[model samples]
Target: MADLPDNASQRRARAFLPALEDREFLRRDELRGLRFAMEYHKADLLLREWGVRSTIVVFGSARIPAPEAVEEMLAAASPGAARAKAERRARLAVWYERARAFARLASVRGGALTQRPDRIRDNVIATGGGPGIMEAANRGAADVGAPSIGFNIGLPHEQEPNPWSTPSLTFSFHYFAMRKMHLAMRANALVVFPGGFGTLDELFEILTLQQTGKAPTMPVVLFGRDYWQRVVRFEALVEEGMIDEGDLSLFDLVDTPEEGWESIRRRGLHAHTPLAEAPDATPRAVDAES
Candidate 1:
């Protein structure tokens, strides 16, 4: 451990260590001890810093796919640029529109909910702390001029906390498990965008936690119908008797930020009206069977 990098983030990741270790050569008890030591000692301070409550875990692709990037870039342009470009630049134009739309949604209501008068309890938007959709989500939260949290982990590529996160709340972790723990510890909901292996890992981990009675019943919403349908045949898996049909209800599919906001609002409002009891003060059962 002394030979490892001295930086806090790198030291936390044990970034010097290999991604895979074969335990076959070690005795079962020895392997267990090794795992315990690795998990228990890693990232203690980072996790402690994350604290509890008022958070959401958002996952998505960092790559931003070329077409999507072009769309975002063009859509951000002024009217003069829009008029000058030919129809061939349309993909960029669309992305620009989506980005602006996302920005607009983030700016209006995101901060208002956190205002002193509203007194919403234990709620913050949490993200993988990377680029792409993760950035978009945190950026949305920031648009409202409120603090947002980022749970970042060390990855070889396509992983870096976007500049939009609130400084005090940013956390970088070495252990994915610990990072996920923070995500679930106070997560009121999960909002997923399109991504690859990392995204699927997070999506399934949360499902497993809920399915196995590990976490409280929380909303999981997938954005972008086209991107989600292409990634996994989840419905097909359910149809083949791999999983119970009702399990499919664990998540909802939606296309817009308005719908995402509504989904979270519904859960937040489930136990109270605007003038009624506070949401968290009420006791709720952890019925994973849902």
Candidate 2:
């Protein structure tokens, strides 16, 4: 074969040379571990830079519409089977309002809008970054002109981040585990509303961490006692010996937003202080699994 041309040698070098900056190379399956680490560190650094000491996580159904949307949905439904579904949705729509009110309470009380540069933001509202209760919670924080976090995840159906979340603080994740990690990492408390499988999964993840002593103890408020009682028989778990009776004490049941806020306040790691004072609080460790 004839000797390769000078240009051919340059082309071969370009093809074989490692390009660390190449997006396609970084996205390969072989680099998955690096991706995980990047996800963890990116969120960790952003939160720290924003001075988010701890979060108040809100978990609930994305299906629940806003209070105003409930009436619109009801009106749009046909008078037969669809009407029943619409009515049920309307009933649950109250939770959206409750979630919003609870978030506002937490943000205002937890010093989200405080001007004290010396204090880190505590109990900043955090959500799954979708519609429904997440939107309500973010909106509540925005109502008070406070910054909030939204940890959005990629899904087949394409869930969008709520507009009310602090635009700079919002994040998107491809890994469910990473998303969940960020959710619980700095959480000072959790307020759970009536939700479906996704909500239950997230609720139990935190419960398991608390039970195992892998995570710090924080208040977990289950909104709507009637709905939770109907859904989960915590007493049954005790009777069956699957969980200790003390496990029931891990979470409190509440009916209203005010009650939920009070429950969390009573159990929060830090005492309530005036917005003017610099809050003395420590960052909760992110190493739950450790």
Candidate 3:
């Protein structure tokens, strides 16, 4: 055969070269470790670029309905046991509303929307990017036109990002460890509404972090005194000597958004002097030594 054209030869040579731009190469099994590291770096860079100084992380059940939707949901359910379950869920609707209000309060007071170029964005509401209290908190931040974050994880059921999260700040992660790391890393405070397995897991993770001095102690507000008291019986843990009595001070039980905010303020926000010209917006590392 006649010699291949020079251009064709060059094209073949280029094709054989391992191009970093090749998606197939990036997806190869050998690149899995690199891919994992990239996931962490990508999120870290984006968060820093967005000036996310710190976040108020919110966790709760995805099943909770908006306050207005509770009545409709309860009415739609069949009578008897089904109706009773709905009624119980409906009673918890207040927590959804409270989460919303708490987020708004934090966003407004935490300098989320401040225009000062010197200010670091602080106390931006962060959530799991699913419905229920997550949507409520994101919606609350959106109510005041503040930026918020959603760290969504891919699952079998495929949780969708809530509509209210700032589109640029919403992130999806394939690794639960990475997702939880991002959630806990910059949290200035944690407000947990009544929830199931996921919420309990997250709550305990932060508590363990604080208990073991793995992370800086931040205000952990367990919203809904009655619900938490009945569900966890934390005092029992103390009495049973499963946890030290001092561990009880790691969290506060608050019934209302105002109380939650106050607890956070007193525990986490009190030391810093309030800024008159614009709050001290510098981004301090959550784990920075005191």
lDDT scores of the candidates, listed in order: 0.60, 0.85, 0.84
Consecutive 10-residue window with the lowest summed lDDT within model 1: 281-290
Per-residue lDDT of candidate 3, residues 1-290 (tens digit): 89765776765664665667677788889988888888798888988988887888999999999988987897799989999999988987887888888877777777676665765687888999999999999888887677889899999999999888888888999888889999999988899999999999999999999999999889999988888998998889889999999999999999888788889888966322244543332222221111
Candidate 2 lDDT: 0.85
TM-score ranking, high to low: 2, 3, 1
Residue 258, candidate 1: Cα error in Å is 1.1
lDDT of 2 by residue, 117-235 (tens): 66577778999999999999988887666788999999998999988888878999999999999999898899999999999999999999999999999999999899999999999
The local lDDT score (0 to 100) that residue 139 gets in candidate 3 is: 84
User: What's the distance in Å from true for residue 222, model 1?
Assistant: 0.5
Alpha carbon deviation, residue 193, candidate 3 (Å): 0.7
Worst 10 residues of 3 by lDDT: 281-290
Q: How would you encode candidate 1's per-residue C-alpha lDDT over 1-290 as one tens digit per residue?
A: 46865587775554455545434443356476665455544434443444333455677766553344565656676677563562345432333234324433433443323334345534556677776666766665565454566778877764677876766667676667767776777677777776779889989999888777788888887877776888788889888998888888888877776786577666451312242322221112222210
Residue pairs with backbone overlap in model 2: none
Query: Per-candidate TM vs. native?
Result: 0.63, 0.88, 0.86
Which sections of candidate 2 miss by over 4 Å?
Answer: 1-20, 275-290
Candidate 1 ranges with C-alpha deviation above 4 Å:
1-52, 65-121, 267-290
